[model samples]
Target: MARIITLTVNPAIDKSTTVAGIGPNTKLRCTQPTFDAGGGGINVSRAIKKLGGTSLCSYFSGGPSGAYLKQLLDEKDIEQSITPIKGFTRENLAVTDTSTNQQYRFGMPGPPIQEAEWQNALKQLELQLNKGDYLVASGKLPPNIPDDFYVKISRIAENKEALFILDTSGEALIKAAKSRVYMLKPNLAELGALCGVTSITDLDLKSLAQEFLENNDCQILVVSLGPKGALLVTKNEMVQVPAPVVHQKSTIGAGDSMVAGMVMSLIWGKSLVDMVRYGVACGTAATMHHGTQLCIKEDADKLYEWIKQQAPILETN
Candidate 1:
């Protein structure tokens, strides 16, 4: 079996709570908070396990919060590989307003990483990756980390002959686009930025996607369209994967869940179309729950069937 490894440079301990209502400058009571292991790659690994798949979750661990994060994942039997650091890992919070069904999220900055710390992380990741492996690296760059951090990982993947799936934004996205990437999961805004445009309408969505694939070495480009599903673009094929609507509670971790589903589909030797459809299914399923909870297997499986029945808007060049 080809190994599946996920690397989250900036990991977190996610805390979620529910309050009766939210108001400005007023005291409100909240329910007991629930804590979970978080960050992009961590969530992907967690979702994969939820779907009865396994992945090695690798991340930076620092301070007591990082320890707690590891403990949370350990409880779920999600295998983890840690890279010790001097700075504390971040802790993010989400508070749900019961009255309005609105979720407010607060994100903290990750601790600044020293040059040696990040360099060591790269060395460890390169050592762990092997040919035919699937390496999923997700989340934003932290303080003191270079924008080209992922570019280095891309090179490592290229040398190792591993498939690199990247999910990130900002300058990191801009630089990594020029590197060798097997797949990219960027939101519509990020995709537009890659195309060097400020806006993209439905009329030109396919064109921009084509342009991205043509101008870069990316084999697969998955532009997440939120509730509308995602657009999957390859060298010769482009299709809009439709998502089934559901009662949405929270949108956290939806993208990571989507990536996890797609990776699992690949592991199962499914076709490209099936892989993206299952990804859309998992993304939609993530919205049906509160907090940072990802897609459950039952929900994702049911949604996958619904997505398969719906006709995909497609084209083949």
Candidate 2:
């Protein structure tokens, strides 16, 4: 078993293609379509694999689409443990308009999970984890699942003395934060939602991040700021990682890849500052790819060096 395990409660088959242009009620000719097994944790696992690390990805799947998702993972040589549900897994579509150079995404709600099915999935996770391991719970919960699902799983990791890294939003994130997780990865918007702030300007981001760390027992907070970069906040210090300016082909899965890079660095005993640096590299790499294609190892390494060269000095007040 790998030392790191990622949990994604809701998964999907993501299909993407390009069209000349997009307009309402207009016929559009799509180019070749691409598909990938997608979910927050799954993308993290994929990014980890790209960075020459291994992690087990656990998620829920069912019916034909689920079967295809499993096959997709197999093709990527990714290790996975999927809980079989009754309904078919959902499919998400992303269409890029070449003429306008704009991308549009259509997402479908995933299949609803039953109580017994969810319990069985938890049992599977319990069987895999042990002391000193790391459990990464990412993404949203499906319908009929409790909001505190990650919280319950965090307790299990706690019982085993494993580190629990939570990447989620809304009530699920709030509930899991109450468990005093090892790390919480939230974008600026999600952080604002948690802090009741509508917009997270550069001047207010650091203070807001500190407030969350103070109020919640969270050990570390990583607030992603998109083009502005990410802020890493710990009890003792705060560091802002600046991303390199790159021509972005896609921004999807950037956060997941960033989490994977940070977690991998942590497992390797890297310093928090270096971890955030590599995280920025991973995120930048993800944007260099098209559609759902995540960061490649070479891109991550190249960007890592560039980030280290311009390392941001952290302050401790």
Candidate 2 C-alpha lDDT tens digits along 164-240: 99899888887788786999989988998889888888788889899899999688898888876788899899998
Lowest summed lDDT window (length 10), candidate 2: 308-317
Task: Give model 2 RMSD, 1 decimal.
Answer: 1.2
* Model 1 whole-model lDDT (C-alpha atoms): 0.93
The parts of candidate 1 lying over 4 Å away from their true place are none
TM-scores, in order shown? 0.98, 0.97
Instruction: Show where candidate 2 strays beyond 4 Å.
Output: none
Q: Any idea what lDDT model 2 has? A: 0.88
Candidate models: Cα lDDT each: 0.93, 0.88
Best by lDDT: 1
Lowest-sum lDDT 10-residue window in model 1: 308-317
